[model samples]
Target: MNWDDMRFLLAVAQAGSLKAAARSLGVDKTTVSRRLRALEAALGRQVVEVRGQGLNLTDFGRRLHRHAEVMRDEMQAVDALAGADTGGALGTVRLTAVPMVINQILVPALDDLRATAPGLRLELIAEARDLSLLRGEADIALRLARPTEGGQSVLARKLGDLDYAAYAVHGAAGEMPWIGYETRMSYLPQAAAIARSAAAEGATDISVNDAETLYRLVCAGHGKTLLPRIVGAAEPRLVELPYRHGALPKRELWLMLRRELRELERVRLVAQWIERTLAVRTSQAQPTRPPDHRDNGADP
Candidate 1:
């Protein structure tokens, strides 16, 4: 009997109906019906019985399904072996990004990545510090700042812009405290912006080291804090506070990697995955100004 026809039987048996099987297989109901008929004709026995809205498998059908399950597993094994031999995504890639981006963005989309690149592994470093790609500390990195130190060996591409905005919990009462960052982080433009706003608002003395903390504090209604629009927009409980004038601070989202390892299959796979993930959010929220393309860290 044809294995392709057996595939249809497998789907029908698992799904319990021709319509459900067709939906699972991405084919029309008639196609599933036709395939099942062909399989029955080849085997010269009734395999499936349609009763009302459900389908029941005959004795032979159960036997056939067992064989089909074995075939499915064998096929998957062969495909995996072939993929590994032919440079499929395999091995580990160390990726680093800030806590908010790691928690709110990358972590959520990992299942999708795993489905596509089952052999690939990820080492996610969630920190505000920029890890050294040159020192082999990481295979790939998603940074809010453009790399100015890795020389020609490091390749940097602007993924998109991360727009910032002040946010407070929905319907939060008058003069919500301004949650600022820790003193050492004051050099960051985002921190400076918050300091200016807090000073003008007569300040509340709350401070934190990271953006994720700022996000959680704002969600808890402790106060308003500067947050990436991408993060703030996703929380329905938090609303973007109106700006007095102009735009909030914008950070450039840059993807950085060692030029030498850029072509490695696993590194390339993770890099593209990171780019695709950020693209969806960045595209939805347009930056006030286009990303700065001047310092791409390309070899001169």
Candidate 2:
């Protein structure tokens, strides 16, 4: 009924608890709860179903949220039209990406749109979990997994096949630390390639999960990690441990958006930026040279 109530509704859905939402909103939990109750009562509808862990938005809440987003965008656009610069989109963009891409790729490419679309506000959430886009958890999701199909909503794009190569610290490629992604998430093609290549080169096995962390650890001489060749190339001495003699596993990366927000300008800008950044990197790549010295495969 009110933007305050709708904002509270989004907070509850996203934060998972009134307390959490209050913390995010920088207000008292009781106030958030009271407002939510009042809104539900005003609407004469059960907006949320309470759960042990958090509140789940009811069907009514879900429908209302979609409309709220449309209204939010329209209002934001109107406000921008009234006061915004001659050319640019303005508003917050929520993006969720896994660690490696966030660190190695996303961070560097953030300034790409600054000259063209300076009004875009980016709120990036880096996590490993598959977040819910339907609930407005994020505007765009860069995921490795194939997207869902045939349901309330659906859309897809085959971005490109991302390649992963095993790498270690300088002079340590032949004697790799042989790390794996955290614990349970290991045995993925990336990790498997690392294991296979390391075993081939007579190296030791060390396990880890997050690609960014694993890459950092490996850079610190803790172990070797399977990293995308392009990302790993950012640092020195992280040689490619390609599958077999010389092949990288083709791990496809896809850009997915809620079927609804696909056309939204903010989401589109971020997505296009990501794609453009990757394209630039791909095009500007130079052939890598072998290490200049003998292979001891140990930290200096």
Deviating ranges (above 4 Å) for candidate 2: 1-89, 149-154, 198-205, 241-247, 285-300
What lDDT does each candidate get?
A: 0.76, 0.69
Candidate 1: regions farther than 4 A off: 1-89, 286-300
The weakest ten consecutive residues by lDDT in model 2 span 291-300
**For residues 1-300, what per-residue lDDT tens digits would candidate 1 score against the true structure?**
778897788778767998888987789999999999999998899999978879989988998888776666456435434434355548777899889999988887788788777888789999888776644567678888877845555789888778897778776624686888888999888898888878777556678998888888888989888888777777778766655534578899888886666656777788878878777766765534322223443221
TM-score of 2: 0.64
When superposed on Cα atoms, how far off is each prediction in RMSD? 18.7, 6.2
Query: What lDDT score goes with residue 77 in model 1?
Result: 38
What lDDT does model 2 reach?
0.69
As a whole number from 0 to 100, the lDDT of residue 151 in candidate 1 is 52
